[model samples]
Target: MPKIALAQIDTVLGDKQKNLSHIKDYCRKAASNQANIICFPELVTTGYSLDILGTELWTFSELRGGETDQLLSSLSTKFDLTIICGFIERGGSLGEIYNSSGVWVPGGKSWKGTFRKIHLVDSERNWFSSGTNIPVFDTPMCKIGIMICHDAGFPEIARILTLSGADILFLPAAWCIHYKDVWNINCASRALENGIHLVAVNRCGKEEKINFFGDSQLISPRGKPLTSTLGDDEGLVFGYVDFNLQAKTRLELPYLRGRRKDLYNIDHSLIV
Candidate 1:
């Protein structure tokens, strides 16, 4: 089993430096707690709900290895920790913008993995391009994958990660008030179906006009809520995952092996 912690920080809208500093402070605390991996909420470096369509916030966005990436790279090395966080990525070779998440480790020249968001919410469709691939990275404790907010709503993303050898899925989200129940149900279902540990870090507090539901949660492979916290507070949510449990559950249940792909073209539907 490996212990992981989420630094559920309350980010100010459009403030990158303050958010980064706050994240570093939280990571230090996680290190003291001996967490093997530490995660932050979606758009953690720059506040979520920024007007990506407008010029005022556009200046805050960066390329994959821009200023924010360098800062994360430096912090990962300085703290000697495996760090995962969310940022609004700009200027990719494939597109103009992407809602992205990244994973970095100490002494690593490049990031362990990066995931551009595959799903988009209302208004988001206008601002960013969706990613085509679901990728995973091998870490010392387990195989890890990254997802951002809306990606969790789609079950195929979870299946892709699991099939790609992801033992643990790290979700960085800014779950708004209207979709709190959706977040709860979707995360649990993803964990149970894939037989993989899920660590979901969601933002707290209101940003712009959106009211966020701050139930940052960690769910076990068996669909159990291991630990959860709610409403506009900033702190760490910790959980320990046993990779052996995933193997045991999948073997016992045999759900993935007995799928009825022959009966229907599930992939034809937007979300099957």
Candidate 2:
């Protein structure tokens, strides 16, 4: 059994230090609970306020292996745990910013993998460039995949990850207040259909203009909610992820094992 935690915390828009401190505190708490891994919400260091901040946030875009990388590496080593947190990424070209995640592993001083959010939505199109690929990272314990907020709506992404050998998917999101019902259904559907344990960490509380709904959940492979937090509050929630149970659930469900590659291919030429 692997113990993991989700930090469903409130973030201050454009305040990097304050937000990082909040995540670090929860990392400590999760470490105390003997958790193997801990995750933070999307844009954990900066609130989901790109519409307001605009290009003003470019300075916060961390270059790969920048200051944030060092800090997260230290935290991972200090806690002896793996850390998955989202951050704004700075690309090589001018005005090239990405909504990305930095994954830090314990006993290591570098990022295990970095994931850029693939689907940009609404106002995000104007601020950040979308990612081209989904990368699954390997930890000493298990393989994990990361998905951002809007990506959760796409079942294809979850299916791809499961096919690529990811048993656990970590979704760090800052979902708004109105789409609660849709979010609930999407999460359950993804886990059940793909046969993977999902660790979805959503933000809580309201920023100046955005009201986030905090219903952070750690769902099992069978779509069972192991532990969850409801309402807008800043705190940490714990859950268990059993590799044996996950394997058993996949066997029982047969969604992955029963896929027929011969009949699953879609032909676009006939759709005229």
Candidate 3:
């Protein structure tokens, strides 16, 4: 069994200082609750309004070993917990920024594996460079797969990770109020279909013109909403998941076993 915490926080766009401070406070709260791994919403340090920032957004994007990454790594060490957080990443070359999610393992000196957003939504294409890698990472408690805001809508991402043996999935999102229904459906459907526990953390409050619906949630392998904070309030949502249960679900339902890969084929060579 593992306890997980989802921090549904309100963020000020481009305010790294304010946002990082808020994250520390929630990390303390989550640590106090004895959570093994805690996750924050997408773009927790900088908020999700980068498209509005134009070239100024590049100023906020941090290189892999930058200050924000160091701070989060220290937080993970201080709390002795694994944290999956979203941040804007600067590639090796100039002007190459990505919408990326990363992990801070408790004993590691730096942020571990990172998963950049592959599916950019609407104006997001104008802002961040899309990622191609779908990486799964190892934590002390479980094998985790990472997803950013728009990635959750695509079933292939989850299926690919599930096929790679990710026991739990983390979705860090800034899902807007208008698409609240889609958010719920997507989260539930992903968990039920994949048979993996999901912790989908969303931001609260408004960032400029976008009003984010703070519905941070934790779902079981069977798609049960164990704990959720569904409103415009910023807070912590906690839930417990057992690997034994996940194993049981796979054994009983066994959808992956029955999957007809031969009949359902999407040729990647023909499509982008």
Candidate 4:
């Protein structure tokens, strides 16, 4: 069994140092609680006000192994726990920036893996470039997958990761209060449909006009919430991932095993 801590905290737009300080505090708390892994909300480093950021979004974006990455690496090493948090990534190409999440393991020099947000929302497109590949990171505890905010709505992403042997999925989001229902449904649906444990953490607070509702939670393979945080507040929610329970639930449901792959083709011409 692995214990995961979800850090549901508010972010100060465009303030990396302040946000990093907050994250460090949470890491210390999670480590004290003996949590093996701790996850933070999307863009925890830079915050989630893209429209307000405007052209200055580039100023906050950093290349792989940059300042934020170094800090996360140091934190993981110091805490002796894996840290997963979202940040703005500066792509290789000029002017290319992405909304990305980095997974840092204790004693590792660099990120274990980085998952860029593949499904960028409307406002996000203006500031961030979408990622193409779906990567599942291998850790000592278990194989882990990451999906940022909007990506959770797409069942295909979760299924693909599950097929790739991801034991658990971490969703770091900045979902707004307006679509709280969608957030709840998507989180539960993805876990239930894939028969995998999911840890969804959303930022809480108002960034510009958007109010992020932090109903951050950990859901079982059966789609039941094992633990959760209430309202839009800054707090930590802890949960355990029991492999035995996940294995049993997958065996009972068999959704992946029963998929009719041959019938589900992407060719539009086949549609009637």
Candidate 5:
């Protein structure tokens, strides 16, 4: 059994120092609790209000192995735990920015792998470019897949990852209060249909005009809520993932095994 921690906290707009500080504090708490892995919400490093930042959002973006990565890597090493968090990534060329999620493993010097958000929603299109590749990262504990915010709404992304042999899916979202039902349904539906463990973390508190409801939860392969933090507040939601239970659930449910790929004539290009 692996212990997972979801850091559902409030983010300060465009304040890297404060955000990083909050992350470190949560990391310390998770480490103290002997958590194997900890995940933060989407755009946690610089807040989720893209329109408020406007053109200045680029200024907060950092290249791979930059300061934020270094700090997170060091923290993972220090705590002997895996850390997954979302950040604004600076692409190879100028003005190319992405809403990306990074995974830092224990004993590593930098991010082990990163997944950019393929599904951009609303204000996200104004600042970040949509990701092309859907990557599943392998770690000592398990094979992990990442979904940032709106990506969770697309069933194809989760199915693709499940097909790619992802044992667990981590969703880092900045979901608004209005779409609370969608958030819950998507999280449960993805986990149950895919027959895989899903950990969805959402940020809490208000940022400018949007209010975020923190209902971070860990759903079992059977679509049951193992652990959750309800209400819009700053806190850590913890749960345990049993690989044996996941395997058993998959065997009993057989959702993935029963998939009729032959009957589905969906065009590849039409997907995504």
Candidate 6:
């Protein structure tokens, strides 16, 4: 069993210093409690975006390997914990931006994986480019996967990660109040479908007029809500990831073993 901490943090728009301070507090608390991994919400550095903030935010953003990357790299090494969090990434000369999540491991350089938010909700599409690739990685704790906020709404991304041997899913989201309910559903559904642990950390508080529902959650392979928190409060929620239980459940059910992929591939659109 692996103990993980999900930090339901309230971020201030364009306030990197404040966000970093808050992250330190969460990290300290997680360390005290012996959490193997500490996850944070989407765009944790710049906060959830607003139209005005998006226009004004580009100047503050950094390309990969810049100051922002260095800071996260240092934190990952210092804490000796794998840190998974979201950020605003600047693509090269193409002048594109992405809603990206990064995975940082201690001692070694952080392996950066990205999700560009395939389903760009509301005003987001105006600012960021859509992500194309869905990837899952092998972590020390387990085979892990990363998906950004809106990607959770798409079943294919989760299914792809699961198919690629992802045992645990990491989601960094900035879900608004109106769509918060759907976010919960997505997390549980992904866990159930994949028969793996799912960890989601969502941003809370006001980023302009949009109030976020901060119900960061951790769901088990059994599709049970192991731990969750809601509303605009900032806190750390901890839960255990039991691989043995997941193994047993998958062994008994064997849903993946029964998939008719050959037939499905012939025409994925065909109703079963």
lDDT preference between candidates 1 and 6, better one: 1
Q: lDDT at 55 for candidate 2?
A: 74
lDDT of 2: 0.87
- Residue 90, candidate 2: how far off, in angstroms? 0.9
Q: How many backbone clashes does candidate 3 have?
A: 0
Give each model's whole-structure lDDT: 0.81, 0.87, 0.88, 0.92, 0.92, 0.78
lDDT of 1 by residue, 85-116 (tens): 88877765654677788888888765776788
True-structure RMSD, every candidate:
2.4, 1.5, 1.5, 1.4, 1.6, 2.4
lDDT by residue for model 5 over 1-272, one digit each (tens)? 88999999998999999999999999999999999999999999999888878877888998877889999999999999899999999887657999999999999988998999999998788788899998999777889999988898899999999999898999999999999999989999999999899999999999988999999999999888999476787998899999899999989999999989899887899778
- Residue 256 error, candidate 5, Å: 0.7
Q: Cα deviation in Å at residue 33, candidate 5?
A: 0.4
In model 1, the runs with Cα more than 4 Å from the true position are 93-95, 261-272
Candidate 3 residue-wise lDDT, 1-272, digit = tens: 88999888888887889988988898899999999899998888887776677887788888868887898899899998899988888886658889998899898888988999999988888888899999989998889999898899999999999999888999999899999999999999899888889999998898778899887888878887888475779888889988888889878878878899898888879987
* Error of model 4, residue 72, in angstroms: 0.6
Residues 128-166 of candidate 2: C-alpha lDDT, one tens digit per residue: 989998888988678999999899999988999889998
TM-score-wise, the better of 1 and 3 is 3
- Tell me the lDDT of model 6 at 20: 78
What is the per-residue lDDT of model 6 for residues 46-152, given as tens digits with 9 covering 90 to 100? 87665768666676556767666777677767777777877787877877787777776776554455555566777777887787777776556777888888888
Candidate 6 regions with alpha-carbon error over 4 angstroms: 228-231, 266-272
TM-score of each: 0.91, 0.96, 0.96, 0.97, 0.96, 0.92
| Pairs of colliding residues, candidate 1 | none
